[model samples]
Target: MSEKATLKRSLGLWAIVALGLGYMTPTVVFDTFGIVAKQTNGVVPLAYIVALVVMLFTAISYGKMVRVFPSAGSAYTYTRETMGANAGFLVGWASLLDYLLLPLVNALIIRLYMESLFPEIPAWIWVVLYVAVVTFINVWSMGSTSGLNSLLVIFTVLLVVTFIVLASVQLYQGMGAGTLFTLNPIAHENVQAVAVLTGATIVCFSFIGFDAITMYTEEAANPNTVPRAIFLTVLIGGGIFFIAAYYTQALFPDLGVFHLLDDTLPEIGLYVGGKAFQLIFLAGAFAATVASGLASHASVSRLLYVMGRNGVLPRKAFGYVHPKFRTPAFNVIFVGAVSLLAIGPSLELISAVINFGALIAFTFVNLSVIAYFAFQQKRYKRPVDIFSYIIMPSIGAGFTGVLWYFLHADAFIGGIVWVSIGISYMLFLTKFFRTKMVDLDFDEADRPIGKEA
Candidate 1:
């Protein structure tokens, strides 16, 4: 199949924004922050603020790089341009885990929720059904998937807003000096700062998907709109959602009242409003999981397609595009199949594996940004400030690295095992499945007519 025939630019700015927000849905953010809030009382918002600052520096670096090299490979392409093909391949290999694990995590969550509703249905059956439906959506066409995602995004935002509004009403009814505005909840002397930060690092996982917007740049209606969408998605989708969710948790003083660690939905619903709120929150949670599943499936397929195109994988099958749909049919099916198999048995394991891979990938992307900026200092003629070049990345990396250390030993072991698998696969590909590297100049990839390249 020819590259031009397979490539389609169909997603607009709003769609891209929805895509990012849909992937970073409130369920994920709330669940993550709830865990941290339980540990540090109401200080979850502080953790989010710190995470946002850290992510912003990386986002700035990504925004600059996206303007220059707007490709489907995103991080892989960026690393290859600055570093070498080998380093890029390693990053790509590691990232494969991020995309692949996301769908599995979603599928597992969906199964758990489905079982709550239909106790008779086997969890594995629900997993299979969820994967099948999401896979069908992903393979049908990019436009169809994006349209569904847009709808899901709207529903998700409304649900979250409803919860927030209800929570605010409850807080107001409680009258003067409610827990909503009190610092006392988070000012406990026993609360360790490092523990709060560590839990917050885990919470940062929900915000991770906004950067996945870069992966779709090749198909974005206007490539320039991507960075803006990403920024807005992070600010509004991740930032505001986190603030509302954490603030609501703060309004209710007792963390133990919710039983967060044991319950998936957390205590936000019960504390904020009541059963009505809990039901609405449950619906939103389901939608968020499904939306995230769909987004992750789409992204993994695209990453696989890019890898196949670059001859890092078996190009003959994975690189093939549907003659009519112009979509990566095999790649989508493959991701779905793998997700179903991987997540059907163990939800807890799936969550741990997914979060572990995600944090590692996040750490790498931030480090890549620092390296990219440092290398381009002379070419861009930008000020080579020590803070930008060294301090910021060091801080981000150190925090993330510490979080990686704090991950459960089982998760650490699982992540290490996955990384080893990726390395082995890369070695095998280099030895047997390799193809000549394509010579596409990223410098000219997004340039317009008569524009400097």
Candidate 2:
């Protein structure tokens, strides 16, 4: 295919926000609520609040990078331009676990959720259905993907609103606690510092989708739209998460009563709104899963396209866009194929690899910001510039570093192994930095990261 077949720019602010939310999946709050509730000893909201704070710095760092290099490569592009090809390659490699496995996770959860809803149906049938639907939409066009994502997001948001209202009514009518507001979800008497921090680490997964908004910079109507979209993505997602956690926690004060930790939210759905509510909740959650898979599918394809076009990966496979739809067809289909692995792995194992890769990529994003300003070029601004470029990223890196340290040992091991593989591939490509590779011209790549090409 010719270079003219590259991704076409058409996304506006709201569309970008929808895509971000789709990737983040506001409904993740339900799927993870039980574990977070257990880990924090009933302080799920506080854990989410803490996670929101830590992720804000990472979001800010991502926004800053878009200004420097508003290209489709995301962390890979930013790291490569500011840090160098070698370091950028590793960032790209680590990020692969994140961009790819996430869709697989999203797809698998829908299957698990569906299998639970309708036990007669085979799980693999649901899994294949989700992957097929997501891949077809992504291969169509960003406009179609964004539009469908927006509608799905609206359904989820409305479901959340309905849950809050129903839960509130139940509370007022002598439900658990018999009150709408309480500090228990924020600071329970039995709260442990270690437990709260651990819960925060898991809650951190909910925040992953927001930074992905920047992946569409090349397709955004205005490059500036990318950063503000990132801000809104995080802020809006945080609002939904906090409200859901607060109400659900308030409704179920005693986490110890639940026989199975994973079934907490589904059971709570019955308490707050009965079988009808449970059905709606499951429907909303399923929609969010499909939408998130679509968003993740697109993101991984773009990252692969950037790598492929740059000669970072095999250009023949990853570099081309479809002539008609102007999408990264090969990569989209490739990721869809990879998502089939969802049928076998334990959710815990997949989650471990995803989180580890996300933290590594987030850590580099923070470092990339510092490097961009301190070593590459520091744009002069009154005061916000210094804080934006240095102080904030430092805090983000610090928080991410702590979480990464406390991450499950399995995650650390998997991440290290993944990186080791990347190192071997990098050596083969560069001949140990004794060779120079030609990058696809910035103009042809989509958007320029720097002020000039």
Which candidate gets the maximum lDDT versus the true structure? 2
Considering summed lDDT, which 10 consecutive residues are worst modelled in model 2? Answer: 443-452
Q: Which candidate should be chosen as best, given TM-score against the real structure?
A: 2
TM for every model, in the order presented, reads 0.81, 0.87
- Residue 162, candidate 2: Cα error in Å is 0.4
How much does each candidate deviate from the true structure in C-alpha RMSD?
Answer: 5.2, 4.1
Instruction: For model 1, give the 10-residue run with minimal summed lDDT.
Output: 442-451
Overall lDDT per candidate, in order of appearance:
0.66, 0.78
User: Which residue runs does candidate 2 get wrong by more than 4 Å?
Assistant: 1-11, 120-122, 132-145, 256-260, 263-265, 315-333, 378-385, 437-453
Output the TM-score of candidate 2: 0.87
Give candidate 1 misplaced runs (Cα > 4 Å). 1-15, 38-42, 145-148, 172-178, 184-186, 218-222, 251-263, 266-271, 320-329, 341-349, 376-399, 431-453
lDDT of 1 at 335: 93
User: Per-residue lDDT tens digits of candidate 2, residues 221-279?
Assistant: 88788888998898889989999999988888786665546535566676789899988
